[model samples]
Target: MGAGIVGLATAWQLQRDGFDVTVIDAHRPGQGASFGNGAQLSYAYVQPLADPSIWAQLPKLLLSRESPFSLRLRLDPAQWAWGLRFLAACRAEVSARSTGTLLALAEESREVLQQLLADTQAHCDFTTSGKLVMYGSEASFAAARHQLDLQRALGGAEQHALSLADCLRVEPALAGSAARYVGGIHTPGECAADCARLCDALHGALQARGVRFVLGAPLGALRREGDRLVAVQAGNDWIEADGFVAALGTGVTAFARRLGVSLPVYPLKGYSLTLDAPVGSGLAPNVSVTDAQRKLVFARLGQRLRVAGLAELAGHDTRIETRRVEQLRRAAREVFPLACAGTETRPWAGLRPATPTGVPIVGRVGGAPANVLFNAGHGALGFTLAAGSARRLSRQLQGVAERPRTAAALIRSAARPAENSA
Candidate 1:
């Protein structure tokens, strides 16, 4: 059980669809990955990391402890099995299909997020400033250009390559290091939000809507009858629901197995750091930025800067490795040196529930306890796609025919030119 963004969003959507919803979590709402992410509501990103070229580079990444990607070899045998499946999905064709699926979900997610904010009259430092991805090397930039073409072919939104000067003009904070980047792509329609604050507001709204939140309660086990879920046991008490949603991130696998359901979800650990910006720093980045080489991402929330990266397969160990933190700081300094000065830094680690094909298992878990639905395995795109996936889940549970534009279809559409823009 989790009270993270996806969980809360799922509860909210269910309530809207006339369901009596109760949410339970092992921690306070939004205290997990949703609280400490880069806070990028990125709709432009549709590509999954299991690209075709990754198989060749896995050994190098695994051997280098300080590399952006890591795998804790001793954790869980299931993690290794998941990693192998992830590698299998790295074929070019597979990656394309996965990208298409995610893009569809992400696009719908953006719309759902906007509607939720508007309906609740909630604000969480939200902005439409969009996202910018810069390339440091010419080769990398060239590759990005090629990928953008594929993105366009896959129904991606309107995007333009920016020259060094234009990129600096769009984001004055990057002027000093303009030379380091050969070029950049700007998704002017994408948006960003203070993820922690958004979750807080959503939790409040859900409470007002009569949704119950059981916090800091660990799930003991599931009480099941023949082909049906009776209730969930937590500690000494049992809580029953008319329906159950498994949005428990990495915790889904074991729970699913107990219920005789097959879930391909596994944990992909990622690290992040938040730094307080100096007064009058003039170093604000309105748009979120992702660096390909270092796998680093930068997003601004008022005066605080969030820098997150490094996907380590460390098997549920939420320990913060100093080396990884240092790498994140180094990347931030390289890109925005002035922003890191005189700032107190806090490091964080979150397990992204990732699936091999990158698409979340959103449909009902057939042959399981009745009314059990899954909305997990989102990986890094949880924040980016939570609202949309929640909306999709709600429609499905209500037996309402989803609009023709489903999440999977939208991703394919977004990869193409027509639906690419916000």
Candidate 2:
């Protein structure tokens, strides 16, 4: 049970099917990854992060203390197991399959999100401002071009390769920093929206539509009745439903463990900073900008700019490091300097549950409970893929067969909940 974008999306879809829906969460809506995310609904740029090129970057990743991507080898067996699987997924073929799977899901998500927006008059600063990803090195640019080709082959959106000058022309805010990049890729139909706002809007809509919420109560346990989850223990209440979904994000791993099951999911911690990006100010970018080298993404949300990056794998820690925040601020400031005046900085860190292949698990694992499903392991693309996954899971619960068997194979695992003990 969760109240983030994914959980809320699932609840909304289930409510549409006439199930009495209830969202369970430890806190209020949008306080998790749904809050202060990169804010880019990357519809077309669905390339899997477990790429082959990461092999070459492993040296810098392992040795450099100042590196943005940090890896701390913990004593936990799950970390090592997940790490090895992640390495195995770094092959070209695996990446291709995953790209296909993600693109299909992303396309569906785009449609679902559009339909959701149309149905509700909720304002979350959603914009089709497009996305521009800048690559500084020729190698990186070539990789980006290859990724663009892959997406095109999978019938993705119309994306254009832009030279440095073209990048500056398209978004003049990058003019000051365009000297470093060789070229970039601009994907049309891409979007940027406040994820926290969407979560809030969904919460309000669900309430108005008669959905229930059990907030401020941390999930305590799952009381299963042999091959079926009859109820969930939240604080002092045991709420039962016809079916249950584990969409707890990072907490899904722990909750799954309580069910005597192990998930390949691990938390990849990422940070963000929100800045004052006033309208008509040339200092901020209206279109979403992704620095391929730094891994930081800048998206303009209303009058604020969301700057987010870094993937730190170090257990379940959610502490915001002042130095790391300073480092991110320094890098972002260097690229987009505003003389450090009249700008506010709001820092945030979140634990995004990610699988090895950067692919999410939508359906259930075989031998789990018959009525239990999983909608977690979305990693960083949680916002981008929430609606699609929710819709897919909804179809599964209703016994509606899914088409395009290939993509569905990757999105949904073979089983449901397993060994429903305790």
Candidate 3:
């Protein structure tokens, strides 16, 4: 039980499906990882973090001062277990398979998001301004082009390898740093928005739909009746429901473990900075931009610019590392110096509940109660894939007969709550 974007999204979907639902979270809605993110609906590029190229960059990732990815080499058992699985999933075949599955879910998510926005009539500064993945090296560009070819093979459209001239034509704001990048892969169907605003709107909509919210309510003991959830112990109060869904981000790991389930979800910390975009300034990005080498994403959110990146595998610490924050600041200044908005920028850091395969664990926990489900571990694409993941789970819980056959097959193993339990 949570009130993050994933939790709120799932509750909304369930409410729409005519289910009585209640959301419980220790913090206010969207105050966790959903609060600050890259702010891009990156649906087309579903590349997992465990790419084959990561093995090649292990040295730089471990030693470089300015490397966007880092591992602190923890002595924690969960970290080691997750790290081993992460290494194993770094093969080419695994990466390709994960990408395919993630893209399918992401595509569905984009559609579901659009439908939800239309149905709820909520405002979140949502915009479909397209996306540009700018590359700094020829090797990286070639690799990305190869990815484009794979997407094409998988029936993906509206994605193309853009020339330098074409990149400038699409997002003229990058002209100032034209010499910094080689080329870009453009996806005109991608979207961007403020995730916090979406969460706030979703919360309001759910309330209007008669859904109950118990904010600042930390989950304690979970009571079960013969492998079926009976009630949730929340700060001395027992809240009973027919079913329960855990969307508590990294907290899901411990909660699941209490029920004898092993979740591979680990926290990967990321940073973001939001600053006002100068009016009439040609320096602000019109389309969302991703710097290939730095692994940072820049999106224009209404009058503000959101720049986010860096993945730190350093446990669940949410402290904002000034060094990392400075790194983002310098990158913003270097790329769009004139649009900085000085020191008035809002800096934030959050732990993304990441998985080795990058495919989220949006299913039921084995050995847990029959009615308990999980919708956590979305890694970096939580907001991007939340709606579709929630919709699928809602249908599964509702025992819908018209569910997509293909999706059913894909999630059969995951849909079973007792898959590995006795």
Candidate 4:
């Protein structure tokens, strides 16, 4: 019913699995939440934000507007309900389980993304440049080690904790702020690309494969007969599909409510800024870098640097607050200094559809239409997990059964500038 990355990727996977596909969206492809996302394809680091450590930062999260994370209490019941469930998921055990699940999905995604790129040959300024996550404080660095320990135990995650010297050795571009960082986690396999460009490439690729697209109209009412869904109204057109997947991002919550399904999806609004950063210039980072404390991520795609971070739970509002944008500017300038130009900045804000547990809901809904499946609530990882999650949903449409708890089980078994030709 939606056509964000999840929808487009789902169509791509389904067509590969020997099924006809149709993608419908109210906006142009990649113009939704997929647009302006942190460009890094961070497959190794899929940790959820709902950690046991959040308890220690609750005061800052709730009370300090200047903090990177902020939550506004609302009159909406959904917000209250989602908040309570999030609190329950803040325990140590739940966080670990979710991490295992996400890591497994990330591995599956890594494999599938390689295959997708190899087959479709889509180009989005892809780069194989590795990712470095730097921590400023001792406590933050220590807390990251716990996640590395979890990944080490689960397997397949080739991440190593690094001292400041080692971090600089791996990503010498950070020499500008050598004294600012205490430690880091280096994953050389992590990559980045222009996500919006990927969507455009996928949209064109799918169209060439005979897939139909109904764009520029909102999905209207769903026609249900008994326990099955037959068709849906998009503008004035009546489109019927044998099966339906709701990849609506934040729009799924309202869409699901019409069908008596209560999806635990809420919007976590985030901000991003893009600036001029040419490669080979000593000013910009050659690899992806994430500031653990400020929650900012910097990814250089072609000649542009994508700086994205900050979490504001203020419903579906997409307004770009000048203060928040300035904060991002300050952070980027402080970290990269000369890399990000003060002017020529492109500011963007999108609502990241998220569940309390950080695990995406990717299967059929109980008691709802038998053919209606969900692929929403991915939060910050919609980019990282889109390919694999869509693949799982495709398997369901093909009657291929996946192993239960595959994240935990899979562990036991286990781009450069030239990428433009992709």
Candidate 5:
């Protein structure tokens, strides 16, 4: 029950499949994370968060107050349990397997996005100019080669390792910043879109297709009959449906728990700042960019430039930390100082529903009240992989044909109890 990109995309795909779909959300459409993302359709980056070295890095990261990553140490036992699971998933073998699975889903989702954009004729400032991951440190650039190899191994033909000069050549706007970059990976076929605009277009399209939207309605609970979810109770009303699909991002975990299912999704809060593109600065990038070391992403969205990154494991709070915003501003200035227009900046925060293994949960929950499906837990790749994930979930919900077991397994992990008790 979300109106974010994942939920809306799932609903759109189902509607196209002739399913009577209704999207319910506690907030208005496109007013959540989907409204305020970095807007990069990053296909070259399919890496999982659970790196083998992440555990070692975490202690240091947590200790460093200015670090891009931070974890709030509350008294809640659930946070501790989630943290332990996150650490456990950081093993080399687990990370490798998760990376492989994510790459497959991301590639599939990319194709679906292409088809959807074409068929819907949706205009949302979409461009396939490509994406670049720039590195300041030689070591960071060297480490990225392994990731590039993985992408190539997974049929990412357009992915290439570019020299610093070559990166600037590909995106002339980065000419001045060439000295700061040692090298970068360029994914030529990757895309970028104004996410908010895309969501608006999709919302209109869904409305035209007779899909209903129940906005500003907080879901209370699932009205269940034995093993079946009969309807969703929201506030003072019950909306009954033949089937149910849950794509509620971070909120999915609680809802699923109430339904006696466990979803390993947790909130990873990220921040973004939007600024007007500097007039006559010639600093607007044609391709989206990721500063690997700083964990910041820069994307040019229409007349505005978006700088977003920094993951904080603070649960469900949208409070904007001034320090975090300053970090984003400083990073953007370092990359393209002239691009800063000195205009009033709009700051935003969103909770990315991150799973320890980095793969999203996208499948039907059997032995349910009805045809219950899930298409959530897509953390940072939500915008990049929404189309593909939604298409696959829609197919399963409609019972058209079964996907391969490997694909199904990647989408639907067996439910496990919270390792750290709340």
Candidate 6:
């Protein structure tokens, strides 16, 4: 029950599949986390969050004030449980397997997104600008090349491994940081789009198709009748549907718990800043740029630029930290001094719903009432994976036989309440 990108996309797909779908959200569509995202449709981003290398950097990361990822020590049982699972996922085999699965889904998503944009003609400030992942050190560049090897082994589109000179040739705007980068990787198939604009466009298109949207309707309770979810109570109004899909993002875990399902989703809070890109300034990057070392991403959307990164686990808190905001600002200025000339800056914070293994849980729940499904826990790649995840869930709802392993695992996990309750 959400109106963000995931929910909207799922509803759109379901409606197209001849289902009467209704969306309920506390706020207007695209007014939540979807409002200010990295705006990158990084189809080739297959790295899992719990990489084997993260273990080596964990200690320094926890101590360093400049680190992009942060953790808050808490006594909460959920936090401890999630942290242990995350550690277990740091194994080489586990991380590699998850990356392979995610890569497949990412490839499917790219195809689905292209068709959606072309068929629907949604104006979302969508751009076909490619993605450039810039590495700073010899070690990092080597790791990226190794990743390119993995991608090639997976047998998909070939991503070019660019030398520093080649990287500059592709996106000359990076001439400003010519001395800072060792090398870069370029994926021309990747793209960037304004996520909020897409959500708004989808909302409008869904409305035109007669799909119902219940905005400003805060969920109160779920109505269940003998192994089936009958309806949803949204502020004294009862909205009934034949089936229900939980795309609630950060709110999914708690909502699932009300139905006796234990979901291992937690929030990885992130921040973003939008600024105006002055025309004729050498500061604007034509293609999306990722600072691999600092874990920041910059994408051009129309006349504005979106910079997003930093992961903080603060337990569903939406408080904006000025220090983190300044850190992003400082990094932006260092990377593109002329880009920060604009006085107006729109800063935003969103809790990206993440799973321990970094793979999303998208399938029917075993413990939930019948006809209830999920399309959440996408973490930072929500926009990237939305279309494919929704398509899978829609196919399942239509009684499709084939299902992904992660989706099956989610259902199995839901059946065993004692599994992840630590």
Local accuracy of candidate 6 as per-residue lDDT tens digits, 1-422: 78899898888888888999889999999887798999998788668778887888798778888898899878789888888878878877776666767777778788888878876799888988899999998988998888788867866465998999999888877888878899999998888999999998999999999998888889997888999999999877999888888999999998988988888889989999999887874677888999987889999999998889999977888889999999889878877777778754768999999888777887766677767888888899999988888888888888873432333365223212111211
Better of 3 and 4 by TM-score: 3
| Local accuracy of candidate 5 as per-residue lDDT tens digits, 1-422 | 68888888888888888889888989877777787788898766877777775766667788886677998888866677677777877776676666666666777778888878886788787888788999888877887887778667756647888999888888777876778889999888887888878888888888998998888789986777766778997767789987788889889878877776666678889999988887664577767888887788888777778889999998888899989988888888888877876574779999998877777777754433345677778888889878877887776766653432232243334222111000
lDDT of 3: 0.83
Residue-by-residue lDDT tens digits, candidate 4, 56-159: 98988678766998877889998888787778778887777777777778788888888888888988888988999999989999989988988789774688
The candidate that achieves the highest TM-score relative to the unseen native structure? 6
Which segments of candidate 1 are over 4 A away from where they belong? 279-282, 401-422
Q: In model 6, which regions exceed 4 Å deviation?
A: 401-422
Residue pairs with colliding backbones in model 5 are: 81-420, 109-388, 228-369, 229-369
Model 2 accuracy (lDDT, Cα): 0.83
Off by over 4 Å in 2: 279-281, 401-422
Candidate 1 per-residue lDDT over residues 1-422, each given as its tens digit:
56889988888788888999888888888887787887888787767887876866678787876578886687567777777777777777777767776777787887888788887777787878777889888877776787788888867777888887888878888866677888888888877777888888988999998998887788987877776687997657688977788889889888788777666677888888888866663475667777776778888777777899788887878888888888887878888877878566678988888877777766465545656777788888899888887887787777753322233342232133222211
User: Total clashes, candidate 5?
Assistant: 4
Over 4 Å off in model 4, which ranges? 278-281, 401-422
Which candidate do you rate higher for TM-score, 2 or 6? 6
* Least accurate 10 contiguous residues by lDDT in model 3: 413-422
Q: TM-scores, in order shown?
A: 0.91, 0.94, 0.94, 0.93, 0.92, 0.94
Candidates in order have lDDT scores of 0.77, 0.83, 0.83, 0.82, 0.77, 0.82
Write model 3 residue lDDT over 345-377, tens digit each, in one string: 668999999877787876664466667788888
